[model samples]
Target: MNKPIGDLHCHPSFKPCNNPDISDIWTYKKNIHPKDLFKGILGVSPRRWMVNLFVKDLATYTQSNLDSCYEGDNRLLFLSIYPIERQFLRPDRPFASSTFVQRFILAQVFGIELKRHIDSRIIQILTGFSSTKVVDYLKSVYDSEYVDYFKTDFSLEYKYINQSHLSCSPNAEDNVATFQLVSNYEEYAALRNQNIIAGILTVEGAHALGEYNSKDLVGDKMIDDLSEENKEKLKASFIRNISALKDKEQFEFTPFFITFAHHFNNLLTGHAKSFGEAKNKSMPGFSNVFNQKNGLDLGISDFGKQLIKSHLLSRHNGQRILIDTKHMSLQARNDYAAIVKALRDEGDAMPIVISHTAINGISTRAKAAERLDTNQLDKKSYVSRWDINITDEDIREVFDSNGIIGVCMHDGRMPGGKFKDLLKSYKKRWPQKEFISKLHTQMFLTNVFHIVKVNLDHIRTLNAQIPIEENRIPEVQAWKTICLGSDNDGIVDPFDNFNTASTLKDFKTRVKNAIDMNFDPLWKRFKILDIKEENYRFFNENEITELKLGLTSEEIVDRIFSDNIETFLSTYFVRAYLEGTEN
Candidate 1:
């Protein structure tokens, strides 16, 4: 029997943006109708099969289609309800006359600026090759007069997912499976036993709590410029929208957590530099597109503080939705962590979550910035050092709170190790089928290694503070916090070998073999660095040797793929036992 896998962050509903009415999750070639062919010619719902076959690296195709997840044995899916942000499609600038021909066509069709507005080169590139449904959807969003487009979009997506399973006969004795959204761990466990693909809801950003304005203002400027009366009105809308989710009609199906920030400032908190590569020389035109300058490094807004204190962190249908600090700016994260700390001090413990993230390999956010500015980061460092990645401080906080870290699988977020080139060269020389799998396996393991190493380092630091005679943290415990959070179907560039959810089953087996074969090198690659003398003691030679052995076990590989996530759910994914009150 194959072991079931779990993805803490993924968007199974994203790729079908152009066709929400579709009955099945997987976009099968047979499902493509004659009308869709006509739509493809018009740049709406383009044939993804062509791209998937010809340009695998393009990654424009859906990764977490329901068919793929069910076939791949991915049972526990923490699906994200990301109300596609309008800012990405319609930015501050207008398009120039000398842009791509497709943009001109799309602009004419949608009656919106195709070039002047679109941010992110990746978005522009994907728009060119894939369906224009996202652009069409965004245009309609702009046309709507509703002040809470986010909530509207969020509800539409939830309903689409909910309705898709209506045709699924749960008791049927066929190979057919359904993606059912579970309320808590109890439902998930029940479904898992029957081989059902269970899904738990999670929103990618607090913007879903009604930050969207229909006026087409740039980023969160509307929030900043809102009149006092309007601010109160928006806040009231926020309360109503959030409350409805916990009402009897939706409580058992609402998101368990909402990511605090995303690509743009959501008026709740500033976000990290998610588009640093756009500023590079190769993408000069995109340098000014994704503007994070206004409140880029600033802390959370007043409205955000109120929302957290009064709604999100409070009881809603006898359960509280957790906050995810994935795209939050450094200052915002620091401020939020302080709040978590304060809550803990007050005898209220809340789990700190970074739903999908990579490691910066730096100790703190400030140090990451300094390293970037001075180009002092280790040249051999494989992981991307962007601020969007979690720092040592974040790992320590999550570890202390017994929170989980779902390491993301985007190539942009977590680049392969320094030996990437060497592995590629070996594959070229060997020209064997297995070499292809081995190459990608080693590359991806680098990311898993970094996260585990950082946590182990944190544990060791804690141990150093205690005397040699005193009890210390077990090194193996660090492995329990790290698990998969592949942001598939979230416009990510996936590794070629493990391109989609269907590839996960094979990837799991490959990971076990790679860990057993490459244990020593991976251990040395992520060796602990010395901390400041005043902060903590350095690891002794004996401690380092013992730590290395503890993490080399094959059990750690299983933990990364499934065990850790299941353990976390059993402990934290539960409703409050007390009598419930409405939000």
Candidate 2:
């Protein structure tokens, strides 16, 4: 096993599984063999299959299961507690037509593989039925009136996290590798010293605040269109949920951050297009069904702004939870950025956060959109140009705010140079060993490389305004902003080579090896920007030379894997902003 590393965002319990103990994470073997399949089909229906001919959004095997995390040496993780948005379940248009169609969409949305079946208890609970049959569950979904289970789901997750903590026996005879939630740096440090993994709670979307209602009415209703009484009720629910989160007596800890927007509009703020075109290409029938682009043009709602100001970003029990800009629409991001700036101007220590994202390599939101309009996938660039990703302007903002960015490991979002085409080619050459590995690893490295470049460029621009005699920003400072936001078990198609949290140990090694093999060629290629590529290059010869001088390959890799996150937490995850008061 390799040394433990940190992950900015992952979900260890989003999948449907049966763990009776509740304190222990369920572990399963890959039993997708023909014999197992035959037995499963005859005895019980399998939820997972070798391939889903109908739906492309197949379930990935457990990526960050506690067993995998313990094995992969992922010691510190910020678990994204997402209450699966209702829009995803409801879908739209064609998907709502037939029962089989509903089942197929449900399988895809829930990430259930054919060889595996969702735990009967879970299915029953989701559908509100006593029968453990899939048909019954579907019937319940279609027949039952709308009911928002967001709060129920959120509370259940808390139970899982808390019980999982209680289950950890780090000092037992087996010395079982396990984790505990750490609210403060001191607790994290203590856990580290004991060789126990640390988990930090983070909410994935503001929608998790509460959205109780029928799937039909609440999934797509804009706040403005809702009746005044309904709007007030929703607001009350949101506030009640927010207050519950602040009740330390119940939750025992505060979430470090809450992402304001996600796949669908929460009526609080709009969201960027989450289900990209590339992903839509996989599920031919469900093209653009999940993204809900109608709300993409909407900015932060008046109510959303108030909640962020009065509840989320405001101090609660002396701990102010930050906001993560991972899935916010450009307009919402802009609005939030201005709010952050204003807060900072008033002497607040708010740090900008973009958890689980890729770099688009474009300078600004408008330019990225222009590039996307012509080149839908932005394959010409070294990284994906999807607007869901962070732009050069976003990177600059992160740097200026002394904030942090978690580079996601999702392949769909980290595309480089006709990445889907490459994947197709790689699939054709399947039996060939290391071919796919080399391809995906390169894609991941490009994202990391571009992030470093963006940070370096930001510093270079700042240095240009100063005297030559003044100390230039050390190039190594560029590495500090990045941490691994793998989005493991978050329904992401991770790098094939680094598929699971267990593989991240190998990922660290691969990163070092990839850097050693490809650094020079990549550096040169990036310097000469093609017409197709955005104007992302901002460093000169002297700056490059200084970067080489300041950090060794080993040092840079180490920072990405663990040290950078530790450093970020040391400064930001403290008792207060006052110096020497981190404890």
TM-scores for every candidate against the unseen true structure: 0.80, 0.82
Q: Cα lDDT for residue 103, model 1? A: 35
Worst 10-residue lDDT window, candidate 1: 278-287
Model 1 local distance difference test score: 0.64
Q: Rate the local accuracy (lDDT) of all candidates.
A: 0.64, 0.66
- Please report the candidate that would top TM-score against the real structure: 2
lDDT top scorer: 2
Model 1, span 47-152: residue lDDT tens = 2333232223446566787777766778788889887766666543333422454334324333343332332223434432123455555555566555464555
lDDT of 2 by residue, 340-399 (tens): 899889877678999899877777876765643223456555566777888878888888
- lDDT for 260 in candidate 1 is 81
> Once superposed on the true structure, which residue ranges of model 2 sit more than 4 Å away at CA?
1-3, 16-23, 26-51, 54-59, 95-150, 169-175, 215-221, 278-291, 316-318, 371-375, 379-382, 467-473, 519-549, 577-583
